[model samples]
Target: MKFLSSLVVLLLLFSCQPQKNASDYEADLIIYGGTSAAITAAVQAKKMGKTVIIVSPDTHLGGLSSGGLGYTDTGNKSVIGGLAREFYHRVYMHYQTDSAWKWQKKDEYGNKGQGTPAMDGENRTMWIFEPHVAEQVFEGFSKENELEIHRNEWLDRESGVTKENGKITQIKTLSGKTYSGKVFIDATYEGDLLAAAGVSYHVGRESNATYGEKWNGVQVGVFQHKHYFNVNISPYVIADDPASGLLPEISTNPPGENGEGDKRLQAYNYRMALSRHPDNRVPFAKPENYDPARYELLARVYAAGRDDTFEKYDPIPNLKTDTNNHGPFSTDYIGKNYAYPEASYEERKDILQEHIDYQKGLMYYLANDPKVPAEVREEMAQWGLAKDEFTDNGNWPHQIYVREARRMIGAYVMTEHDVLGAKTVPEPVGMGSYSLDSHNAQRFVTAEGFVQNEGDIGVHPENPYSISYGTLVPKKEECTNLIVPVCVSSSHTAFGSIRMEPVFMILGQSAAAAASLAIDQGIPVQELSYADLKVVLDEEKQILTQEK
Candidate 1:
């Protein structure tokens, strides 16, 4: 009788206490991505005294910034401010130490950059660095801020998002984990969370007419870059034979009207980090699906006397090169990633593997194939994947260069006129000055029976233009508390200029500021006053407009 009375008293005491769920996963701000923007956004949110959590689909942080694109595309570096500029300053500080330069001395690099010195002492910024160094800096930012990151957590796109009166209450991942937050920021390259949340976005190019833009649509003959085929190459398997089928990778469909819209996406590739130093180089291994016939057109390109294979082997800090797409058939896998934006996770993995196989096979063929020119092959043979970078991913970059993806149709759509500074941007939050640079969308057989690359446009903006705060805000009716920075509201032409790593970081910080302010004032992101947002942004040292 005594033991039963004690047990009943214990049960009653436990029931009266508050229940705590270990799996609650609640926070003040929830950021979805592992890009450079994600890092900056989380840092800004945490700085504003918000309990923030980063749910990243990527195993590695820093996106392309650490994934072999160490050569920063910084236009008018003076306009770069806030956390974005701080990131570059951190790179400069890292290189100042003797231990940072392992393979080569700092003096040998000669401070080469995109029309500016790679390492500027006066400005205290470094524009070029190694992939591992970039990753270290980004990781340092997270560690210093004590930010919590859940890596490799992919969103369950089908039914993960739970909305209460147009605002996201919480999101669930594929692992059956749920995260609740007052505000959410989608900073992914693919805009995965934004799309899963039923936000309206565009998948491909908007017609010039759709946005009153000059460089938005099908650019069949506008070959501004060296990516187009300079020499006339026949598209048929048997040269000039109509009955013969088209060559591999050459689309049979028409290249489309000059300025009309299409669902084509720009090329995608891994910005390879290669080293010629024998001690740190790993030879390119042939892929399991290697086919010599796949590169027959490349051999033909060699026959046409184009030896510009190493044109874009831009040097970085540690005797390594950030090798990007150069010639007509170098690296950008044209016409291959059209479905990546809207693809399921499993389907996207398959597409990613295909791209990996294609690029890996290309490197092996270029270095080993007898059909390639002896000089070209010998030069290529000297270069191989960097042994020290991407240590976990077989020395290959983990993140593929996703130049463009789903762009949100949000509070305001930035068009070409805005990018060119013809129409003034209202409520400025950041600035971008890079040219409208788009890679080829298709390698198709032209009407003249010649193979040609289309949809490569490079139109420079007249001046550094301000980006409006509206670009980051979703339509109030769609979702009030959500903010998107990486895939902001912009047309294809405008995105070309805004899609830089520095610009993404800038907008990310701005987004978090708006989110923090909205949460504090109990207002939607769209309804937050620009005056209040600008005051905070100015205090944070963000360059919102061109300085007089």
Candidate 2:
């Protein structure tokens, strides 16, 4: 009897181990990318009683949310609820402990965050935190939910995705690992998996007429940020000597007419984590390929008596600031990132290295160069990269902020009208209240012989508007069991508003819930009832409608 009982137990234990599919590992759901949305989606899948795995190319998880963008770009806190809000609440919980404030006392850090109370005593949500704290919180989410993430796994774009009957059956990574699932979610910033799976997507700006948007395409006359050259700065390499040709960063082509369509994308930069604390700062080191000549324009701008470089040095916890591109000729490598959207991996690496060199050189120039003003140089010398952040990349940010990438053109593309709350979204999965914001796309010489920056716009939406469920799923004919949360379907102008980190998290949870429901009903993701999805989301505390 004892031998028979042992045999039965051994058979059951072997059966419980996951049986590998002929293709790769099999699960109920497979998630791609390592963005914050990707993490949240995997967690939601785990909660929905599904076996899920994350196959990501990123060495570090939580894209910009953990990559030195500590100052939350939260438009309205009320609209952020559910697991997204839970994330912020967890950030608060981490700081509530006495030991969490290592460098500074919690009482002294008086950051009434985003013009509102950063510490909501009632809601227990913290709007502001450090990069490492945010990353730790996200990692905790992964551990508590038993979420499996296979980092550093790149998807082979060419022959990776295996589809059958208009659905992704299995996906192969460059490392030869494969994942088969009943449902899939593409949460990447680049929409690599979506495009590989044959889903239609759009890159760069669309014409205003294409979506009846006032701020969709090449914006020449409209200027919102202080990133434009104010004075009449000459565009020539030798400062008004036309025969010497244009400067290194300035483009020779025309910026095109207003409202014209173009393939140019917004500038990309690293959201730096600079610290004033001496113990926690690593002084800026010049890159191996640093060229001081690259910053000639910024020097000229400073020479013209523009000292607003410190305007965007917004402070976060532990005496660190989320240093962003402030003035014209700042760290925004304009017109250089146009090829990034469709560039090959090698080409993309080159582009990313260029940005890093440019930004790092900018810091060294501001701190140590003789051309910088003495007072400004002295002030900048006090700031350096935070010692405890992004240690894998020499204390710099691991991820460059890819503000916009390939947006899927799914069954319903949310337009500017939807952004401005002029039209109603059919099914409410999330809400975005941030401004329709895009950084400069191209920097060129105007007809007046002055260097100017183009493609920056900031139009505030009227209220927190709902995001649609259709935007998450592809067209019924395109794919049946896939959902895209990060690279959602929307026009360029509308995506500007919908691309906030909080909104991405909200959409991630909603997409996972939809995926679970589709699996339960044994139907396509697009065929899953929005009414049923809403009930699940509501139970999970997702604020589909705007909060009062």
Candidate 3:
């Protein structure tokens, strides 16, 4: 009887050792994002004959590509080669068929139809499309590659799992499921994976003295755009009267010492998705806490007969517009999102909803309020929420424009010298040509007591500049096993141009290629020779030089 009992215990112990099933868990690469870059990286990994999976926190596949802002910012489109170009090509293909335009007829819409290719096949530049069409193109890529995707899987960012040698052995989700992989790419805008891996990163603006950059922080005297007070607009109940109580949105803090540093972050607002389709349009509804007093400054502007209030509704596709924050007081929820960078998920959610309410309420006020100028109200009424888009979230954008977030202090720190055409980089992975664009950082009382905005830089890049691989790699001591394509280390000004979506896609593909090569060559990603990486990038059709 004792011998039989020991035999049973041995059988159970042998069965308890978990066997690796062929289908249960396995992959050559695991990507942690659902942004456009994340999709491109996963697709590239699969194309290279590696098994890959995308674990995204978003329910949707494409990030801002589908989340409105479809009016692409493709500066130096020729530099956008590789998978990024393929994405636009696919968008062109989608519109080639007449059926793609179901709502509007091809002849009626003419050459300017929805999802139509803005790029001449030979020109190598395209920068316009519909939101749904961008989503469809991303979907097509996923389907053609047959990539495995798990959406809405938030990473257990704090102490969930790790290996002894700084490798991410397993990443558990909020639901307690674990995903293990040999190689990982953090394509997220937040750099959550990279931060969790103990990588050094920075939130808010960095001091100019830290990097010797001209446009690093506290840009008080530099007003390059018309976003601030061209003419004094009062924030008080009585125009130019200081004793009538302070204005609702104006910040009381003194604009920090010029060229000095502060913790102020660039403003964030929803890139509203609106359409003219009468059947599909949901007219802006008055928000629950709609206060007419919140828009008193706007009314003051209108009362002063500023006719340019509606000029900011930039066009997108199919009679839609990617409306942005324009003028002194617009869609930007000033002073409300200072803590968004390191905020928890629940806190972030609250911030997002607050922005939604503020923006929606602003629209409702413009369209319905009798106090608004007749011309402004008429123009506002013409535009409404795009009835067919973002069906899940009530026709509003799902993602907030996180303009600047936790920037990884990586191997290569790109500074103003690179963007100002003063110095050239030795190793180039991609190129950025957009101006050093940053929206307002704070709204303050001007010298004369009227409220004004500061920190809006639109300086053009002196020339097309190259992005280095060092910008993607972390310090060896920080984390050797991670690659960060998004949230790369750079001077605040340089990052402005590199933050575009197409550039992110280009970097994503390049990061994946480097990761695969590192795995094959048995070396850390930082140790891989640039010559070899350049060869693969060139062969893969990635544009490395402006002259090319």
Give Cα-based local distance difference scores for all models. Answer: 0.92, 0.88, 0.80
After the best TM-score superposition of candidate 3, give how far the Cα of residue 124 lies from its true spot, in angstroms. Answer: 7.5
**Residue range 1-548, candidate 3, lDDT tens digits:** 99999999999998999886443455778889999989888887887778888889998877887778777777767678899988887776766677777566545542421233464455433466678888888888899999899888898877755765766677777866677777788989888888788889887777889878888788876878767766778877887788887777788789887667677778888888787777767899999999988888888777766667766666655667777888877888877778887888898899888888888899999898998988778877777998888888888888778888778899998877887777777688887877888888898887778777887888887568889999988887776667888888887777888889988899998888888887777777778899989988898798877752
Candidate with better lDDT, 1 vs 2: 1
lDDT of 1 by residue, 445-527 (tens): 87788889998988988789999999998898999989999999999988998999999999999999999999999888889
Question: Distance from true position, residue 292, model 1, in Å?
Answer: 1.5
Q: Count the backbone clashes (under 3 Å) in each candidate.
A: 0, 0, 0
| Cα lDDT of model 2 by residue, 156-197, tens digit | 899999999998999999889999999999998899999999
TM-scores for the candidates: 0.97, 0.95, 0.93
Better of 2 and 3 by TM-score: 2
lDDT of 3 at 464: 81
Q: Report the C-alpha displacement of residue 241, candidate 2, in angstroms.
A: 1.6
Q: Residue 209 deviation, candidate 1, in Å?
A: 0.9
The list of candidate 1 runs beyond 4 A from truth reads 1-20
Give the C-alpha miss distance for residue 490 in model 3, angstroms. 1.1
